[model samples]
Target: MSVESSAHTAAPRRVVIENCAIATVDARDTEYTSGHLVVAGNRIESLGSGPAPAGLEHVARRIDGTGHLVTPGLVNTHHHFYQWITRGLAQDRNLFDWLVTLYPLWAGIDDEMCYAAAQGSAAALLRSGCTTSTDHAYVFPKGGGDILGAEIRALAELGMRFQPTRGSMDLGESHGGLPPDTCVEDTDAALAATAEAIDRWHDPSFDSMLRVTAAPCSPFSVTRELLRGAAELARAKGVRLHTHGAETVEEEAFCREKFGMGPTDYLESVGWLGEDVWMAHCVHLNDSDITKFAATGTGVAHCPSSNARVAAGIARVPDLLAAGVPVGLGVDGAASNESGELGAELRNALLIARLRGGPAALTVRQSLRLGTMGGAKVLGREHEIGSLEPGKLADLAMWRLDGVSHAGLADPVAALVLGAAAPLTLLLVNGREVVEQGALSRVDEEEIARNVTRAVTRLHGG
Candidate 1:
């Protein structure tokens, strides 16, 4: 929908939250032990130390944020919303093996399944303090019936700021690709459909709640022609490009054997490396590959738990950061990372980085940045939704740190990142309340659960 069509006609709505610890996650990493934030309409009006300035009028809401920590709402840079219903299906497999096991079931998915899955995924993300999320949905069953639109409706109903890619796979098992023939699309058909989705759904306005991306699934599942074509189409349409790359050893081997080069090199050959592109996983990138990624301004969507779940080696996150590559945290697919908690990913990324590069590999604030500002940079929305600054979108999370799990922490940021997943006192997306008092405000959780149960049963042929 166009921004004008969906614009609110009501008078300006303002909310004030005080007595909270604010971590801006800006370039300077500004922090205030006791701060006040003002949200006017859909943007942050002002935020700084101490109470809000007096004489504020027409206040819509005033929150006593005692013992709470406020930060930018987490941004999930990569996900497969369609995989929510299929969680735990391939529990004991590597990346390739897991896809092989799940392909046939995925090939049978239709619009109904995708809507339920998208709802479930959005619910999990919001409960975990995620406001904006990008979905990489590549499996397009021929008779699925507008799967992308189904997911778009589901997320919009839940008030999620969404950037969903019209992902496609042109190379199938018949062509030595990973996905089955039924799950892949014709190269030209996929490109045309992607352009159609972009024209119909993409809104380039600054406060747009929905944007479209063009993504060809992966090296092993998409032909070189499709990759180059997708990149060209994305640039022409002013949308970003996303895909899976360097995710596992098997994928690296596949690229080397088939394309006579590494995954990074193959991507560069197809014009896939650029500021407009962000690749997921990237766990197997070598030093030279990291150099190219930095030089080309490419981004990485780091998925620590998913990599660990599939036994994919730890990505060199510290080295990647040192090389000036934009790295963001991702929950990945629920089928692989069943928790689907973007909040927990902050800690997971920290622990994994330390495991790979020692105690000081990643700081608590750095991990938080990965989920907030870094993610915004990767998705090219840094100026819009990454920090708690005036003129930016009021997409922020208020974590209740006074509870048993986080009280007396002294450092709110550390409590949020190193401690247990804190419950959100409130979650705001575009100055609108999505999660209030730790529950979704717009949709019933019980209803979402029931829908997911039904969808899963249907997918299982029950």
Candidate 2:
């Protein structure tokens, strides 16, 4: 396949990495104790055991991957990138109380603030071995000034594959929603903006670096009309749908009181459950809800740390997996998950599943899969970006396992998911290095940190 070049003059370059432990995360759970992977342009040319074949032609860069474990880069299924600058607020509050406190604060956001926050969020994700991420950006202030555009620009600059939803919340506090009036939009206007975003940014190519989704914020924060409209818009435009659902018991109660149904049922009523739809949380899903999700091919973005931080109950992840519902890990937003590292969610998902369903609930490899293949499935990119197979997008993480954090584990996957977040040796998105030596390669970390500080100061009126 031909790759796009910046100057539109040269063909794509090829790179090789040898002497690493490769965990393909493929259908058969393939692994190589020592192997070599060749990347030609934005696709994996080939990968197999032992040294690379002699006289590999036209090599541009070669990396010695000793003491590293290479896996398909972790994919983040849900996040609020704008939440990076607004972390630490509403710490002691549940979902409802937290939104009540932060809605006004978030309402002041603009393009400048979103660009800075998105960079900070992407920086954290890149360093933590995440190469692909889907952001649910719903809080569009009236004069937000290209909020979605800002996010798209920031991630594009950083060279990470992005799927950002044009999310909307039309139900304000007056309408029994959690958000303040200023943070919500009109139903028709929201739908129009969502469609506009897709036209402007969504790329559906096999090696697509950016795609757009239509997201109505959540069951409690959106009107039933907005939910139905968003689903229709996304399907008509051939884009996926995303939203928050079943996040907490309070949300369940809100749905029951207002819509006379549970969150899942309300979603299904509005045509929001399908292969193209993936909901965040699903923390309060019942057995029937799980069955519905599986039967309809609805996916879930399991945000374990954020759920725990907000006192949301443990999600029935093991049960969902058993019922054949696709499950993926999410760092959520930085406000609820301050670390904002997708790599850590691998460990958190494992522990949370085991906490709810005992020791055998989720294995280390399963945890890694949740962050990789499962996430790819949720976002409808499974065939293109999930695994490290030939012809797949060359998006993968080279994790360093020789450090103090993970030196002695026999199984590299064990040290990765069961232990603390393993530091990345490199992170590749579309065969381009977004991160190297655990730092962003395309931008300066210090510059990103400074921008975040400025954005925070502006947001807080400091």
Candidate 3:
């Protein structure tokens, strides 16, 4: 069980993983047992379960994964990385009320809090076998913190792909938005800062690990002009756009009460319906709305735990997939979920889908696909990473099924989802091991924990 460090250590540029069950979540979620994956550089050079490839037998070093599950690294499509510091607050409230209650506390956040929370959230996600993930950090307190830059730095230091959006709030409580006046930004400043983030961090390359996005918070927090301006600016800067939409019934009621339309129509009016745009928590779209998203190439980030925790109805995820809408899984913000584990949410996705659409609705393959492939599509990084196919970035995880949770399991993929364990054995981002043998190999855990403690204490007025 001696895993060679990388690229054969010295002789060759390859990693040969043999005798494992590789679950390739391609167009079809296929499994091949007793297989081998030849990793050269940052791509899977070859993979199959038959006789070894011609050159594999001559590789420098090899480790056998006799009873392990080697799958594409999990992708988290949506999150508020900063909310790791704000966990366990304003619970039991609906979406709008919850935002109102937490806005003041979030306004108190500074750069240190943002960095600690970002690092902590990304670390937890990586621990949960996730490689590439997205962060929708939208609470930019005026004159308080460098939240976006800090998030980028945290992700860079941890060696994970980060889609840190420059989320802004131009409309406040005084102007009928969720945030307070102290937290909201002027329209000019918001747009300017978004452009600057794009210039500084937005990398559109195939192997990029850091990307910038423009997110104007949500419907109730941003004006119509800001939404259109965000889209225009993002397109001009060649980046993507993201925001919250149709998350709860309260949001629907607010749209009807305030704008006299549904959330889907609200998106259309604000020029936010198209490719390169994905909205989070679309739990309340109708048939026509679903068709609109399908036709327009819009993506949805389905948050099962957060929805059920807040008593929001389950998203029509099966229906959305059937209707051709690109839907992915998200753990949502920690303040709502309290735990940022994509594996747990994948289990919840299956359980909740079964509760709604009966058994055999959301299959185990579909759940993993949503987390791996569907998530890559949602975050607009499908070509770069997601599956264990060749030419994709070397982002993956190995779940050692010899543990207690997966005891007596025959099928490795099934054991992986049902096992309910986070922080996988080996996690890699761009061919770099961030979590090796169930511990973080990327950043400092004790330092991050100390920073998070200080941030949380400061948040509690200590």
Candidate 4:
């Protein structure tokens, strides 16, 4: 089954998907072989087996899902969309060295570069079955004007559900931080800009296309004062908080030497270890830290590919899950992971979990949950867009099982995670199709690639 076109229209506000295998990642983890789902006005109206609803039969748009596998659209809990411009550069470096090498180039980013990079990255994610993502754009060059705003505009054009974090790094080398002075910002200016972004873009309603989070880049690059202030401001404004935590042993040593405690302790001292916060790359944490996270409802975004690429240690995903901590998958940054494909991230997650524990450490269903429902839980969006229920948003991905990769797979749903990554036949967010026939419908892929290449050339001075 394939969608005819990717044209954006509201004429057919209702759609019925008939005769597909549905993996509903709901509370019960339900699965149906010959299921039917109805989408009406940006929300799922109903779903079951045998027949469509009475009124949905007359809907204009009907997608024949004879040989397709449908599931909730995957959610990416953490990313740096602008890093798509720097893929394959600094390939052999560790975390600290990679950041130092790329900071200067990132300082050269302008409004156009941000737009192109965000568009390209979002396009890649859509093709890989991600309908919702959180972009951590923390670099604020000295003279760059509203780079976050440009990123938001570009993502909107792609029709993706975006959470653009107002990320900051106010501690520079002059202040004993990793980033240079030109790459950091004044604390007052950063706070004000964050508030402005929240006021201008954040919509806390159901099925909102855009939301904002306050993220101070990381422990070594930001000040303790900024962390405390950002958390207070986010809570006062009713937004979420995010940052990098416990990613490396070197980072743990730095936190201990600088703050007189471990990463998790420092986070608590700054009043950031709470339910409204989610941290990226928690690859190193003590047993106590895991207990604290489970107790406080803190979330972790696991970036398996980036961790392996940088020689960072494997994260304790099975332990975290057993402890009842909310854990989600993340494609940290295109430069580090070298791929913004969320489906590939899902596969890496399964392999890495089994590598650390045993073959039974992570199942295909569990990994799929981490990419979908677990991600929604991380972002506090489980109520709206995680599963395919009657009241949930119409965000879904359809993969055709007719391809060679899945030719003889007996279980199509399991093949999606255990088999090779496959292109999405159709991707819908808020009842609007963004990808159709294995291509982005709203944006021209070739044009986005060309613009991103031009931006990278300009930044590299070639």
Best candidate per lDDT, number? Answer: 1
**TM-scores for all candidates?**
0.97, 0.97, 0.96, 0.97
Candidate 2: misplaced stretches above 4 Å? Answer: 1-12
**How do the candidates rank by lDDT, highest first?**
1, 2, 4, 3
Q: Candidate 1: which stretches are off by over 4 Å?
A: 1-10
Candidate 2, 1-462: lDDT as tens digits: 112223332456777888999999999999999999999899999999999888766677778888889999999999999999999999999998998888899999999999999999999999998999999999888777999999999999999999999999999989788888999999999999998999999999988999999999998789989998999889999999999999999999999999899999989999998999999999999889999999999999999999999999899998999999999889999999999999889999989888889999999999999999999999999999889999999999999898888898999999998887788878889999898777799998999999999999999999
- Candidate 4 on 144-214: residue-level lDDT in tens? 77799999999999999999899999999998899988899888888888989999999999879999999
lDDT of each: 0.93, 0.92, 0.83, 0.90
> lDDT tens digits, residues 211-325, model 1?
9999999999999999999999999988999999999999989999999998999999999999999999999998999999999999999999999999999999999999999
Q: Residue 362 error for model 3, in Å?
A: 0.8
For model 4 the local lDDT of residue 116 reads 87
- Tens digits of per-residue lDDT for model 3 on 1-462? 576543335533566778888898977666797788777666777888864577453354466776678899888888988789888877788777888888888888878788899888988888888888888877777666677888888888988877777888899889887789988888888899889889988888898888888998888888888899999999988888999989888889889999999999998898898878899989999999999999999999899999987888889899999988888889888888887878787788888998999998898888888889899998888887779887788888888887777768877777887665733667778876788888789678898899899989987799
C-alpha RMSD in Å of predicted model 2 compared with the true structure = 3.2
With a 3 Å backbone cut-off (N, CA, C), the pairs that clash in candidate 2 are: none
